[model samples]
Target: MHRTYSLRSTRAPTASQIQNPPPPPSSTKSGRFFGRGGLGHALRRNTAGAFAPDLAKKLSQLVKMEKNVMRSLEMVAKERMDVAQQLSIWGEGCDEDVSDVTDKLGVLIYEIGELEDQYVDRYDQYRITMKSIRNIEASVQPSRDRKQKITDQIAHLKYKEPNSPKIVVLEQELVRAEAESLVAEAQLSNITREKIKAAYSYQFDALREHCEKVAIIAGYGKHLLELIDDTPVTPGETRAAYDGYEASKAIIQDCEDALTNWVSQNAAVSAKLSVRSRQLSQRRRNNIKRRSEQGVGHDLSSQDAPLNDEVSWESTGQQQDEYDDAEEEEDDETEPSKHSMLLNGDGSNGEKRGRSQEAVAA
Candidate 1:
């Protein structure tokens, strides 16, 4: 019952803690009918899309589903900690070596639970970011509805009273509605892209950190296991006196230090894309850059001069072809240098070359 490695503290409650008391910890038991989530989760998920505006319905359900995921993670973290405590309790009646190893293992498992809890907090950040997107989607729905309603009214009047004076007024209103809808739609598009990128980036970084830390804990757990004497013994042959206390404590300390010092900069795992994936990613980035540049130029040119429709179309096509050709040439020039760097294993040369190429491009 000596819980030396437990994460709980015995200090008095802080002012903030006293003012805003934390909720009681949830039981490990699942609910009677609806499983761990109980009735609320099911109700929220089933009703999420029904009450949402048409434009935001799918996204609304997605947000609700993410909430369910977070709840499940919370349950899992709690259960993991419970399992760790159970492991330590179960090991108490065993022989010394087994008892010591299991207790240390419980410590590592409990740390994983703590890490999972922290991950849940960080994941809430991603969920909150996604909520921004859902809010924007909901706001944009009204403008879309207004535009459609106006258009329908205009069509009905044109059919019933072809020459009515109200038709002109409706047309003007329709134009205004269309403008507002356009602005709203643009805002939605921009915010959706921005928030989606940010939200997923946060989630992925958190996932990577959590996974790496768990792996580190597993590695040290293996070292602790090596201290156990798993060798078979003859009948009634008592094992040697338990003497791995210092070594086990050192391993635990080392693990704690490693966890404390762990940072994203020193992350040991990396994702390497295949050649085709890299090429596709590069092409996608290049296309987005070129299109953005072209859009700015097109906007400026339109403001400066009014060109004939046919002439503008032809010039735009020609400009697009020129951009494609230039991009191809740049890719060709960079590919050889990239390959050489990979072969030589000299990242500094690649960095210098990249800087020079960027300077030339500028």
Candidate 2:
């Protein structure tokens, strides 16, 4: 039997310890005025937003709360390991079947603790990503302040000195400030959306994996329980000798192999939506598509004036070409008639020609 499997103290490093080193003890004493919960957790939650920039205060508080959550998980993992060790120690003096099963259960429980510790690390990744959003929010505040200040100054000057030369200069400064603020606001919006999606996706993925692995451990723990003989025996009759030692060991090995090979794609549990849920989900998707189409239509309608202007300019150019061609054809037709009239020596044609020549000379 492995010494690591039991609570026996040994100078040499145990297999369990080597594989998953225990986390360091928390720096703060476990029990103070707040008991095991720690005073820092309460203080952190209540005071986190007090000093944060106005724009970032709420998110800053959220980040602090997440830190508290991580701390709680760490405490839980450590306690779980302690309980596992205690369980193994208490079972050492029990019947052979009881001892074997409890020890194996301890192994599974300790593995759960290790999984929790790892989950805390992944959760911190999410918290750090959220901090990026807070940082961007804090940086954007200055641009907003600058724009507001410029507008106030321009307003104050226009009221006190309506014709002040400085008003024009301040107006120019205000325009530049507004432009800078616009860019800063746009960057803040883009980064907030991107980081929020990334952070939550990371958190949910970690949570799913942790839960699935814990479920796997629980199932195998139940298998280990079956090794013990639970049948009612006569008070004087002794139970049969324990022959499940090898079987118990096999169960533990199988559990370890299962956990080692587990992956997201191989998850046994799934959330299958019911018919109503499927319909509701599809309806939501259709509504989003409809709204998007409406938005595109609105955008196109707003652009109609420019498109109409371009079409009118094209049509005007074509009309001008036709007008020029018509004038040239009319001039060609009239010139022949005027020449024939001059050949007949009509007095009216001669008089009109003399007047046209006099008007040209004039």
Candidate 3:
């Protein structure tokens, strides 16, 4: 379609043009619309007229389908994430289970170690027990053999002492020897049986190893068990024992040295005390000499009475010969000598002796 408009159409709009004067009706070519011969009606049918509402409906359906597809894709992606997370959780669970198993295995190893120690200790005791049993058996065997020999000897003695009444005593000795032999044989049998039984007793290490094997078969770790079992323990135990022995020896040596030092110190103290006593005595003698000198000085300073009180100082007689007659005058009045014999003085002769006593006291 082509549409041609002429200026002559302004004369009069013809009814024929409205009814049947078009080339092709758009409504007839496609679908129905209101009968139209006007430009406004044709333009309305062309664009916003015919296709507008249907296009809006089709666009709305497309939008809905698109939203559904996006939602489905999103759901699929979410499901994938959930699956991945579940797998991670399962992996973690598996790891936890493995860790738990390993921990149990470790605990089992420690138990086995303890059992091993007990086993070794028990083995040592068993060896001693066996030795004791052997010793007992050996003793019993000898006693039995000796008793048998004695029995044979008494029987022969009876035969040799024919016609002697001592034969009855010899026969009695033979019966006693046979009884002792039987008793010795019984004792030996008992010791041997006990030793055999003790040899078969279960050791702690053997039991522990058995339990470990059982656990290993029950889904525990086998390699770890073997590794733990094969660990080097003997060297460690030997080292510990040696260290203990060395420490004990060192302690004993220290004690001995301490005792020796204590004794030496005591002897030294005694000797020092003796020397100090001698020095004190010497100092005492020196002190006495110094005191005597001080007393002498004091006495000289004071010039007290004479120190010799046992002797008396008499008055001088001045009467000369009578031949000089005038110069010699005799006193008729005479007082008797009042100073008689003197008593013994104290250690010192004067008041200085009292000072000496005070010094000694101080």
Candidate 4:
């Protein structure tokens, strides 16, 4: 009877088995037992190789979804400001006794708050999913490496003489490799079938939910703008409302742009700092290694003093920023409230408003 041989089979081959080994076409290349693909894919395709490539592909898609969600949230924030300006116009044109418009404004603010909360929740879920996938892939790498080494050893043994002293050692190794490879394959199978499916489902649902919330936010914004446009008012009041809204939007946009720029710059700075630190660490390690190879003993503690100095400088900068914030807070508490001046029409505060208006005009 002819027996079939599977890759990484634990059975020890008899002399007859070695003379006429059963070889599957898929496992043959260059007249060798291992397949055409590299060692990384020789054992039923690394068991996890099928899903390994998909990890980065899914992460890229998730990142793109996150960017879209951020843009939508920014649009919603701008719309909230527009709605507030419209509510302000409604208050100005009506009699002092009218409170209904303010009530509507409150409802709109509450709805915006809810949308912001939803965005935060979805973003958190995205981060968790990304981290889980990365960790799973990392765990699978060592098993794949061990399997590759064992396969290479097996291939080397195939070329050696049958009566060589290494045959017994090779047989023992084959048994060990078979056991280890089977365990790794089983682990990868479970991960790909269960964990990966759950993570992908969560990300897909989160992206869809985020898009729906953004649509609802857009609808509410369009409705509010239409109400403002249709309100009956004098031409001057109408122009003034639009002018204020545009100016507010411009200021808000400038602030958002500045904040975005600041974040990008800080991120770049942090990355550069991290790279510099790693480079310094590598240099120190290389110096120590070279010294040891030359039979010399150098004081690494003294050599590392410069790295400590850089750490202290970073701490100092953080302390300075905290001090500046404390001083700004004190100044704000000592000064009269700008909002109170705008609302009260105090004669003394009118000069402050005029200066502010001049600054805005400039």
Candidate 5:
């Protein structure tokens, strides 16, 4: 015993059978029986000999037809399977893209934060430099004023310093004034006034350079973010890509939809094939029954009843119902539930699959 529908023929078609082929059996509305008139006509119209060669030719043609339909069904099932494989590959690719973009966004965020910290740090440095410059000026201003006053007083004392007591005291006061001026100069040197001036120039240059560099990088990153946000995603708009992230996402969704539809279509065709197999079984049985009633005991057991012992006709309807139930259950559990026609294998973004949670999180 083998599968219920075996299109194999024991004998090859003769040249006469090829030239004048008989008609195949017609299916009935009940789906279990064939059109009696068609089968009986094929069997009775032959008058060549005792052996119904014409009837045999008709049965061969029927088998050929079944084989052709079965081949077509198998081809469709294969196509549907190819679509599923492509869907899985496309989905994994999209996941990679989403992950890549997510990583890039994270890097951008971290870089921006570093730039902000640099900006604050640079500003603090600039502020401290300015404060040191102000403090140095405040410390040196009084000494500079005092030195100018002593020069003026010594000019007047030089004219009266020979013998008068007031002249001697004024001269001594002038000497003390000169020494105080020298002391103030030494104190100013201790403060490293020249070094502070040099620091002012160099620090400002370094800070400006650092700040400008950080600003440029931060600006560039911000511009990139804006571009991503501003890109038009609506259909019928311009096409673009940010490292192909958006395009890949759209493709993944389209593939998912196509796979779902193809799978559903495969299920439908499988059901049809099952029905067709049953029809072929019933037609063969009818022919055998008629032959037996006429006392022509032609053996069709090998051709008609070749299914596995575990398989029974009683469960055919139940099996189909179960297949349909399983299909519905699978649709509920998977993501591509919405119905769609698989027009082509190309993953075109002509339609939108609703935003997925993973896409949103990324």
Candidate 6:
């Protein structure tokens, strides 16, 4: 049985602590509001992977125990019937054989009753724990969402404007805040999930164990019942039957109390793990995003080379461009003049073309 927990030192949270406590839940809307994917998208995430294997194992074991109990119950019932027949024979005062079956039958019945009571009580307790877990899961959802948005916005801003140290500091604060929120959400989720598993596990184990015990007792009682049926009733047989009845009555009544309460501290352990792990995962993502944004920001903010170097390159390029432009203009001017000269060649300028020119001149 675990003891209850009490916090040590009853001081209220300081302003700094509250401010720095945690990050928000990573909801898409909140992420977007905080510039994470919007809350709608965030809801779509982290829904699965919650039901782990340990829970399955516990449930499987419970099933096996139940099977054993059923088989045992059947065998015990048949044996009880045989015992009845023997009791009738004994009244006839005939053959000599085994002891009376009444006591054994009584014991078996008592055990069954006890097992049933345990079932009811244990289930009630489990229901209570489940309720608590659900309540906690619900309570934290809103806060978790709000925090996610802040973290996202901070990250987005940091990514967009990397040049400012003040912004950097502000981004860091947001990241820190988001980290805290992630932790809280994870812790809450883990607690709820783990508690549910444990509750089911406990119920299953208890039921299985009790049923197994019952089955065994029933089998033994059946064997005794068989023995009595084979035996002839005599004076001694009367005493045996009476004793069997009383014992069964007591055992059956007590079986109701067979259930044990395990006030779990498992919830706390799970909560701690959940909160820490969740926060850690988120922080890792945030760090990666932050570094990338910072790198990009740094690149953007880096100073350009001196203005003198820029001016020199510009001047050189302009000079080359001017030279090319002049050369092109000169070529254009020469093309037209060359064509006109060919077309209007005078005899003196082109003595060989005089014949062609005279023909055209005429």
Choose the strongest candidate by TM-score.
1
Candidates ranked by TM-score: 1, 2, 4, 6, 5, 3
> Could you give the candidate ranking by lDDT, starting with the highest?
1, 2, 4, 6, 5, 3
- Judging by lDDT, tell me the better candidate of 3 and 4: 4
Candidate with top lDDT is 1
**Tens-digit lDDT string for candidate 5 (1-362):** 00111011122442322443322321110111212234423432332112212212333233333323322333343343344333433443444433333333333333333233233333333334433433333333444444456555555656655444565665665566456545544544544454456645544543443344434444443433443434446877754433645443343333223322322112221223588899999999899789889987333323321222223333533543453343223113333311112223342111111112242111
Residue-level lDDT of model 6, residues 56-134, one tens digit each, is 2333233223323332333343344334334433433332222223332433443354344334444444544554454
lDDT of 4 by residue, 88-146 (tens): 44554454222222323333443354345344445445445554554444344444554
TM-score of each: 0.73, 0.69, 0.26, 0.36, 0.28, 0.31
Clashing pairs in 1: none
After best superposition, candidate 4 residue 139: deviation in angstroms?
Answer: 1.9
Q: Write down the RMSD of all candidates, one decimal each.
A: 19.9, 36.4, 70.2, 29.5, 49.8, 40.6
Q: Evaluate candidate 2 by giving its C-alpha RMSD to the native, one decimal.
A: 36.4
C-alpha lDDT of all candidate models, in order: 0.65, 0.65, 0.33, 0.40, 0.36, 0.39
Error of 2 at 126 (Å): 0.8
Write down the lDDT that model 3 would get: 0.33
Model 5 residue 329 CA deviation in Å: 78
Q: Which stretches of candidate 2 lie over 4 Å from their true place?
A: 1-36, 273-362
Model 4 steric clash pairs: none
Model 6 stretches with alpha carbons more than 4 Å out: 1-107, 148-177, 189-197, 228-362
Candidate 1: residue 72 lDDT (0-100): 81
| Whole-model lDDT, model 6 | 0.39
Q: List the residue pairs that clash in candidate 2.
A: none
Residue ranges of candidate 4 with Cα displaced over 4 Å = 1-117, 157-162, 217-226, 229-362
Error of 1 at 36 (Å): 4.8
Q: Give model 3's TM-score versus the native structure.
A: 0.26
